[model samples]
Target: MLKTILSISGKPGLFRLVSHGKNMLIVESLTDKKRVPAYAKDKVISLGDIAIYTNETEVPLHEVLTSVKNKENGAKITVPSNTNELRTYFAEVLPDFDRERVYPSDIKKLLTWYNILIGADITDFTPEEEPATEETTAETETNAEEKTE
Candidate 1:
């Protein structure tokens, strides 16, 4: 039996898999429904959001089951229904997003959080800044003196 797990997605008419099997198990569904069968429970190869069927890995179906069961609600492995248009939509919009405005979070390196997300890999980011300017400082001293009076 072909113990396989398919991370299924679609790009318009072409259906693709996030292949994870030790053997090649790529196939196209002739039916109209959109569900990866339990039969293909382990033969999946996960590469980003893509699935491939090649001689690479050996994942048990139970692991996929466990992962799915344990997965956070929004984090489940799935493709949207408008997946056919996703690539086109992404291609058009991705470059427009403000990469220039993004600054890495101050706590990202200090807090041991998940690094799997593709955030900016900048070593130049600094957390601390010098104290406020002199005019602002003098206003604060004057306010303190007034408060004490």
Candidate 2:
């Protein structure tokens, strides 16, 4: 089921819920005023608040109650990652390439593509063979003269 959060205080008030899909919640505050909380999208439900949703986290009102209960009773709670945060995480892991070299402009995928595209071979690293030595130049000159003779 989709996760949610709800909060309940001593007084009657509304709470907010934000999820990728609709979920059910039961909030009964047994405090002094017996505040019956309602579901809200943004702020509190009774206040007609809108909720925020994405791949990362959901600040749903109903889940607020669950969150508070967990805190009071020592239950476990896990916060979801935000979509933007995850994207940024991936971006940081991606290699930093010369901007001029990448074509399509997708930094993330381009990093992976580059690793597969080109590779070095043993021949490409043949030990620094000394430059054309003076002896080699003289041998070539002598060969040319022999042909003329």
Candidate 3:
């Protein structure tokens, strides 16, 4: 899901979280399947945490991505190079997207990200449910034992 997908600053494309290292993360590029170490100094952001400014409120990136998917019928879209046309295409996808706050460059990036995601066969934009941790499982067992006592 989006949580495991990362966008490293200065990096060309999105990366999938492969493993954790000391003071760094091992990330696999979504485009090339190449593994690289994203150091702690790098500004690594999960796609799940990103949101787009809207007229009324902020919309999560996943929702926006889903909207784009719906608009494109799950196919890669040709991002318009012209600024005005790009805005028009984005407006069709998100009608209430803030015209003032959302720059054309931002829209272009979103569309490009969508195309990359589609090309990588990453269609699911929803967040996956987090699995229970050891601490939580132990707490649950303790509670059950206390109740039985």
Candidate 4:
């Protein structure tokens, strides 16, 4: 669902990918529906591809956003301007998030993005499960054979 949503650096809000051109992409603003051509020089990052740093590993942005949504009961959260408050809020959502790697600004951006997504009625953040690998499929077949024997 978030595949077409893009966060272009230097742009104020999110954009939905419309179509691709030879050296650029045609995008429409999620907020104003203003269609614009994003050049190859623009830094465009998909919301699906973004992740947050955790102590154990990186957690996908969608999961973090989902947690925020669930915690706030689908309401927009007031982004804390104070650094300590921001840290506390992030800790509540992701206790094991790497404090050093995840800065206050990053947290602020996440909260802002979450609010934007929520306002746009794009709350579904559930990612599709990956298909079983060849090795796992083979193991399942072998186990079935043994069970039948």
Candidate 5:
């Protein structure tokens, strides 16, 4: 699910991946649903591909967002612009996050993105549900044929 959501550097807001072109990506802004073409030159990073540095290791962005969501009771967060406040909130959300590797700006960006995601009701970061297997499809077809017969 997160794979379809992209964060293009130099862009103001989050964008949803609509399709891929030869040398560009077709993305729709999550905030206003505006469709735009992002060129290969743009630094486009999928939320699924992003992770934060933790004291123990790296933690996926989705996991960190989930932690924030649980902390906020799935409510929209008002991201703090102040560095110290942002750091305090992030600490509550993720205590073991590496302060050195993860800067204040990074925390602010995460907060803003996470809030946008929550506001858009994109909280669930679970993997996409798989399609039915061929065997299952065949069984269903056979059952339908038997009923018709």
Candidate 6:
């Protein structure tokens, strides 16, 4: 899922979260499989935390990516360089995408990211489910006991 994928500022490509140490995170490049340490000073963002502006509300990156995948049929797309063409292409993918808020560069970035993800063979754009905590487990047991009683 996108949770473990990272985009470090000033970095060229996406990275996978490998591990973390004090004041730094060890990230592996999705493109080259190179491991590098990202310091606290670096602005690192998880793709899962990204959202695109829409007419009504913001849409999560995963949903946008899924839309792109559906549009492209799970294949890499040729990113349109022309601004108007790019906008038109993006409109086809996300019809309700905010016209005023979403810039052409943003659309281009989204398309480029989609291509990168596809190249990496990461077709699944669904968010990863959070594991159940101990509290939730106990609550489930208590509910089961009550049902039995």
- TM-scores of the models, in the given order? 0.18, 0.18, 0.86, 0.85, 0.84, 0.92
Candidate 2 residue lDDT tens string, 1-149: 11222333332322223332343334433223233434333332321122223234433322333333334243322322554443443333332322333333333332222221111110111123458989999999999999999
Stretches of candidate 5 off by over 4 Å are 129-149
Cα lDDT tens digits for candidate 3, 41-70:
999999999999989999999999999999
- Which is the winner by lDDT between candidate 2 and candidate 3? 3
Query: In each prediction, how many residue pairs overlap at the backbone (N, C-alpha, C within less than 3 A)?
Result: 18, 24, 0, 0, 0, 0
After TM-score superposition, the amount by which residue 110's alpha carbon in candidate 4 deviates from its true location, in angstroms, is: 0.5
Give stretches of model 2 more than 4 Å off: 1-44, 47-55, 74-149
- Residue 85 accuracy (lDDT) in model 5: 94
Q: Whose lDDT is higher: candidate 1's or candidate 2's?
A: 2
What do the candidate models score in CA lDDT, each in turn? 0.31, 0.32, 0.93, 0.92, 0.91, 0.93
Q: Each candidate: RMSD to true structure?
A: 21.0, 27.8, 3.9, 3.0, 5.6, 1.7
Model 3: which residue pairs collide? none
Name the weakest run of 10 consecutive residues (lDDT summed) in model 2.
117-126
Q: Best candidate per TM-score, number?
A: 6
Candidate 6, residue 19: how far the Cα is off, in Å: 0.8
True-structure RMSD for candidate 3 = 3.9
* Residue 31 Cα positional deviation in candidate 6, in Å, after optimal superposition: 0.8
Q: Give the TM-score (vs. native) of candidate 6.
A: 0.92
Of 3 and 4, the candidate ahead on TM-score is: 3
For model 6, state the Cα shift of residue 139 in Å.
2.6
